[model samples]
Target: MKGKDHFLVAGRITWDFRRLSEEETDWGNKILFLPAAKNMSMLVVESSPWNANDFGIPYPTYFHPAKDSEVFEWQERMRSLERKWLFSFAGAPRPDNPKSIRGQIIDQCRNSKVGKLLECDFRESKCHAPSSIMQMFQGSLFCLQPQGDSYTRRSAFDSMLAGWIPVFFHPGSAYTQYTWHLPKNYTTYSVFIPEDDIRKRNVSIKERLLQIPPEQVKVMRENVINLIPGLIYADPRSELETLKDAFDVSVQAIIDKVTRLRKNMIEGRTEYDNFLEENSWKYALLEEGQREAGGHVWDPFFSKPKPGEDSSSDSNGGTTISADAAKNSWKSEQRDKTQ
Candidate 1:
């Protein structure tokens, strides 16, 4: 619906047929969701820049419950608890993918005396509880965070909730992502080790961690703990007037965006309509040739097709060509002209 209702979405959403049930799709327009497969309605909230760029939508925060309630007496205990290990990592191995770095980190932790590996498969009933993981974070100086399945994971935030500094292996793991939630000065509360250094044996995580002074570590830990309340999502039924949590920040962002959009539309309705016609993925999915090809609507990858160019088949059933293919084609044309 245009200019009337807006939708806010969080978490990883996919448009795979196998994941959808027959009943879910059969229901009429009773349900509204953030459009998938490159549909930007100006009403959707995305997860990351990658998702926003791919789908042409605004990004939103992935909210998680604050562990404050679960970890009773955490403030008093965390300050007093002796950190037994230099660093700790608690994640299962993804043996299926050789390129996955979790397996390598597990191996390194196993060999190093300072590294503590708390390996468990969440698929099993016993390993499902977050208590063991929280306890490990409480007893460790730094919590190792490697990107798993996606660029970001809930573990990094969880480690911070326990007042433990996070060590990231990839820029996508933290630095490049979560701009709205995390500080620009990443070193204030987190550590970054280039994945290449770990793979090349150029850096020792244990040695690097040990190099940090106790005072600096204490400061970082304090900052992490202070950030916990903001990063968390409290109960909606309770008053959130004073507390500016992630959910609050995300909702505010959406409101600002919608306000600007509505104002712009009101001032120049014809121009705005034209812009939407050029950029909107506003079409019936079942109807053929309704969607623009080339790329996702409003995405930079899209450009008006050239003379004599024709539409082609794609996996998405859209006439869109891959960005790389378009780049190569443009290069070929330039070379031909030069020749």
Candidate 2:
């Protein structure tokens, strides 16, 4: 697929995923979704969560009623997010980012916490290829699928392909994908938890996940292993569009999606320039306002200066809050912190 210059994205926007915690934790909902490009052959996806299991997906997919949603509000939030996300990421590298969830999860699995539970020694557990990653996911009984950036992610594909049941984190996400044909409980194939219920109901997400019946997990594994060959990107005769095309004629129809994406990459920046030019007045005014009011004030993590740096200086002389500064501010281990 990459030979045809296909832009296969595997992850979602990190910024948006963090935004979900701001929403209500529990709600049931659905959404209607349609792709922008033809056949969705250019930019396919498989963005599951780290804790859940998702198998392989090599097509342009969108979750209607989107992710990080507990109610109709999630649907609306996803609609707004999709435009800036999937379409806008037309030319993004195929989830090759160093900080991807897959990498972090693999790292965690080798570390002391999960490592001791697995009863296995860490083998450095690093894989240089996507296949290796898939193998790692397959070797396990349950694959965790955590929605990155407001939706379910690649972990779903990983689990389904490996015959592991996906342990879904978001409420109202999985069943909605199957048009409610699939069971939401551990009976049919998967397990899910409403995000808000974790803290309010005194639920231990990991404990509950570990408690899934072994028989149910085996059934889910069967479903996934059977589903993999058809869904993953591995077709020489027909490219990797077989599974989607099997569903509909429109699925295989090719558009100049890649070319258009490259073009947008050029055009989008120009539009941003025009927008900045249009709003230069407002930006200038805001800059002036910040100049007058500073210090450990309201915008500590972003607009304000660093704890030790001076804000008055420009890129060279100034001490601004860089991206590294923000990441460095986290004070605790995320799993140990109570909601």
Count clashing residue pairs per candidate.
Answer: 1, 32
Q: List the residue pairs that clash in candidate 1.
A: 294-320
Computed on alpha carbons, the lDDT of every model, listed in order, comes to: 0.56, 0.33
What's model 1's lDDT at 239?
A: 46
Lowest lDDT 10-mer window, candidate 2?
83-92
lDDT (Cα, tens digit) per residue for candidate 2, span 75-161: 233223211100000001114323223333333344423321121112232322456554454345555554332343444554454
What overall lDDT, based on C-alpha atoms, would model 1 receive against the true structure?
Answer: 0.56
Q: Could you tell me every candidate's TM-score relative to the true structure?
A: 0.62, 0.36
Residue 32, candidate 1: how far off, in angstroms?
Answer: 12
| Model 1 root-mean-square deviation | 13.6
lDDT tens digits, residue span 229-267, model 1: 666666666645455776776567567655765676677
